[model samples]
Structure formats: C-alpha cells, structure tokens
Target: PDCEKNVKTLVDGFAAEGSPIVLVRHDSGDPESPLHPDRAGNAFKPALDGVEPALVVPKHVHSAFHGEVDLHAWLRREEIGEILVCGIQTNRCCETTARLGGDLGYDVGFVIDATHTFDEPAQNGRDALGADLLAQATATNLHGHFANVTTTAEVLGAIPAAG
Candidate 1:
C-alpha cells in the first residue's frame, strides 16, 4: 500500500535534487498478462503520472541491467556511480536489479519500503511465505552484501535540497 507513495516521495525528492532518474517498466511477452505492453498495467501508477524520468527502460527480464536499454552503459556514459532501486515485486525484479547493480560495481541503495511483493506458495508441502516475510528476506539478502537496504525517509533525507 505504501509502496507507491514511498516511490513517489523518492521520485519527487530525486527530481528536486536534479538527480538522474531512470524508470524501468516490465513488458511481459504474454499478451494477456497485465504487464504486457498493450495492457493498462503497463502504465505507471497514478502517483507517478506526471513524473518525467531521464530514461525509461522497457524490460523483458527481471534484472533492469539486462533490459532493452543498456542501463549500465547509460549510467557509465552519464558518469553516474550510484543508484537507488525501488519497484514492484520485492523478491523478484527489485532484488534482481540490486544484486546485478552491485555486481556491476554501482553503489546500490535498495529502498526496501518502496517495494512490495505477493505471498508465494511453497513447494514440496512447505509453508507459504507471506508478503511481509518475503520483503524482509529480500532486505536481508541485499543489505550489506548486494546493496544497502534503506527506507524511503533515509533516501529522501540523503538527497540534496534544490538550490
């Protein structure tokens, strides 16, 4: 619920500070999928409606680094050394991006609260993992290793004020 709001806060804060903002959109190959290019879910949320990003990356894979647009190359060309990652599916796309960003040598900040995920059914009769648990796991997995797991407030506070 708070994911979208937190993302908007981060977007506004970064924009105000003149930071390069990159938005990644997932384009599912299946036409019937909600995230398909022709579907309404392909559009950004209402909170992000008027936000303009420096780049919009259309991705078919979970990792933003492996998207249609070469995110790593763009960052290198722009001389951007650090990145803040936030998006839907905390355990999937968000986590994947953070992990790959770290491997690619970018200073990565995984905004934990700005991401969300759904409960996943376990295999082999194992217990289902709740969304909250999955999100926490993602934070634990990324923090200190792949990225610095942080909150929306922390990220906003780090952004320099608009001069």
Candidate 2:
C-alpha cells in the first residue's frame, strides 16, 4: 500500500537533517502460515533507497511494543519526544502502536495518508466495512482521540529539517 511510498518522504527528511531513522519490521510468522517475512511482504511497499536504518525491529503481533520491548528502551535512551507513526493495517498494528506510543507519553503524530490498510470482515467476516470506509472510520476514531491524524506533507513540513 501507500505506506511504503509515503515513508520515503520521512526518510528523505531525516536524511537531509542528518538525523537517525529507525525501521521496525513485522514478521508474524502467520498464525495460519509460517515464514511471514518474505521479501515482498517484509517492508512497506516502495521501500526507500539510500536510507541507512539505525535500528531494525522484528515484531509478531499488532502491537510493536509487545514484540519489541527494546524500542521503548531505545526511545527513552534517545530521548525521543515525539513519534511519527505510519504503517500497514491501520486498524491493527498501526492503531495499536499509536495507542501504545501515546500511553508511553510520546507526542504521537498519525500520518493519515502515509498509512495503508485493507478491509476486514467483522465478527468472523460476517459484518464488515470496505477498505476505504474502514480507513475513513479509523481516521475519524484517531483524529483528536488518540493522536493528531495528519497528512504526509503536513507532517514533513512541521519538522525543522523540511523548512
């Protein structure tokens, strides 16, 4: 989805600023299927080129905090004041992590456009919404509720480096 391409903008911004960037990769090993971290499914779509990741986190569940405890420790050690969160499955991992980040006292910024998610059936695929509707609902639920849901350009512009 767009999360892969959208993150490139963040990488570029951080690169220009001479700051460090951390990459958290998810590998659930599929509750049904194993070997979840395939090359195609490893990183977000449209992966950025020429960006050296400072950290690589491997996670299983939807909550990054649960899989990668070191991320919390690392963020604390590095004095990470704010978290710019965007990733796949808006209702699952991204949403869970954003909530965790807020609970951890980080200034959470949700890049609404930078994240991508698919439609999910509710109650065992019985009642559910489409992807677009789900995305919109997620946005509405997140905006002013958990974090500041914004766009990629707006988030980049808010940074000092983008100036």
Candidate 3:
C-alpha cells in the first residue's frame, strides 16, 4: 500500500533529521498474555519494508506502555514532546499506546494506514482475523478518544521541512 511506503519514507526522513524512531514490538507467546501467543512481534507488517528499527519495545500486553515500554522515560530522555505512533494491530497496541502516550504528556499521532491487523474469527474472514474491522474500530475510537489519527502523506506534509 502507498501508506506503508510513505511511512517508510517518513521513518527514513525522521532518521535523516536525527529524530529517534521508537518501535513498539508486541509479543504473543501466551494466549493468557495480552498480546501473547499469536500476537507477539506481529506489530510490524510488510509495509515497514525492511526498514531498520531504532528501538524495539517488547510488549507482552496491548499497551506498549506496559512491561518495560518505558516510553515515557524514553521520551523524557530524548527530550521529545511529540510521538509518531505507527505499528501493527491497530485496535490493540496502537490504541493502547496512544492513550498511554497522552496520559504521559506526549503529543500522540497515528498513521492509520501504516498499521493493520487481523480481526478475530468472530468477524468472519472464514475463521480468519478481520484486520479491516480492527483497523476501522481503532480509527473510530482513537481519532477523538485519545490521539489524532492521520495519514502518512498528511503527516509528512505537516512536518516543517518536509513542506
């Protein structure tokens, strides 16, 4: 998708600007665990296109803020006030992380199309996870519920020098 490519470009642009790119990796090892068993490390999708990760936050829960996400502390250490939150499983980590980011006083932003997920079999993708549903749900809830969800192009255009 264009969004994935654009997001990679954005990630690279940030690197060129010397901005620290924070990556939140979710682990799905134990079904009992939030993102455990089948959900871990699935945070990144093919859209990332092999882009190197700057920081990998191994989160066992839905929220990256949990289990050593240390996002808040990391933000402080980097003197960052705004976060460009992008990753997989939109309805889960993306939503959770955005809310937590807001609570911690960082300006949270979402690259809606850059992230994705598979909805549970409950949604009927022939027993497949309906990521479409999850992504939509996340967009609905996060748009005004916690953070501002925007597209990669719009976000990149919003960057001062990118303009």
Q: Rank the candidates by lDDT, best first.
A: 1, 2, 3
Would you list the C-alpha lDDT of every candidate in the order shown?
Answer: 0.92, 0.76, 0.73
Top of the candidates by lDDT? 1
Q: What would the per-residue lDDT of candidate 2 be over residues 1-163, giving only the tens digit for each residue?
A: 5676778877788778877777667886764444277546565445666678677678888777776657888888888878877877787778888888878888888887878888778877678778888878878877777778888889778779796
Candidate 3 structure lDDT: 0.73
> Which scores greater on TM-score, model 1 or model 2?
1
Instruction: Tell me the tens digit of each residue's lDDT in model 3 across 1-163.
Output: 4556766878877766767777776676666664553654455656555666667777768787785667677768878899877766577777888988877777888888777666477655566646777787788887876788898888878777676
Clash totals for all candidate models? 0, 0, 12
Q: Is candidate 1 or candidate 2 better by lDDT?
A: 1
| Top-down TM-score ranking | 1, 2, 3
Off by over 4 Å in 1: none
Whole-model lDDT, model 1:
0.92
Q: What is the lDDT of residue 40 in candidate 2?
A: 60
Q: How many times do residue backbones clash in model 1?
A: 0
